[model samples]
Target: MDLDRASSELNEKLSAIGGTANVAVLKSVVTQASSAIPVMPLYIAMVFKKMREEGVHEGCMEQIYRMFSQRLYKADGTAPEVDDQNRLRLDDWELRDDIQQHCRDLWPQITSENLKELTDYQEYKDEFLSLFGFGIEGIDYEADVNPNVAFDVIDI
Candidate 1:
């Protein structure tokens, strides 16, 4: 069977289990499996767009800050919250019902022509480029730099 069919069957099986939570898990799995599947990239793009519109989009720095300040080192010394499986739920915001529902509602309406109009593909591309320091601000990509520059290592 083709990937889309397999994905559809998986959705059917998950739906048979009868829970929105299970669907959410399926969506997460699909998003993570984007490398192997074709449609998942589009799904991820839509999800990211929805997240940005909701004002809950977070980059690596923001997520790390939350993990450190809220989870790892709380001022009250309380233990970090975990799910039933004893896993940190740092992705709680992205897995929210409203966000997922918005993506679900928009998924069917997306097409190659409407991709930019319906999704945050441009922002996604920019963020992906920024990972390699390409689109960052205040940096001269054309400037020459010494490859062996040494810096002090401070251990805390």
Candidate 2:
């Protein structure tokens, strides 16, 4: 009934068979866009870890390019692949059975003390920061830049 017990039971069920029932429960409980279930961060971190280790991790731009080039605009002119609900399955890599199973296996072993050891929390933090243009390669964050730069406007 308590949070910890509920989380533990969910983890047990998830790890036992990687069941969709537990995933549905997680999805229902974390309905708000800005809110998440208690274990989601850890689960995502583990998923990232496994994906990176397997060399299948991709950035947002790469995913979009793949979607357009390989799926949406294929040279063969065949119809794009879609799921049962008629949505494009662009997340096929992320939803691979091996990746899901890996995350499930790591679910029960994770704890506050072993979080960094068991998951890619650091990478997650870095990626989150990159959204605001931080941690980008070849850019000098410490360099001073003129706040105002004059640019010529072209009339259409």
* Best model number under TM-score: 1
lDDT of 1 by residue, 44-154 (tens): 678877878898877666776887788667989886665654345678878899998998889888888999999987776665566566778888889999899889999
Give the residue spans of candidate 2 off by over 4 A.
1-37, 133-156
| Candidate 2 lDDT for residue 124 | 68
TM-scores, all models, native as reference: 0.61, 0.60
Give residue 90's error in model 1 in angstroms. Answer: 1.1
Q: How far out, in Å, is residue 125 in model 2?
A: 0.8
TM-score of 1: 0.61
How high is the CA lDDT of each candidate model?
Answer: 0.68, 0.66
- Tell me the spans in candidate 1 whose CA falls farther than 4 Å from its real position: 1-37, 132-156
Q: Candidate 2, residue 151: CA error in Å?
A: 17
Candidate 2 is scored at a TM of 0.60
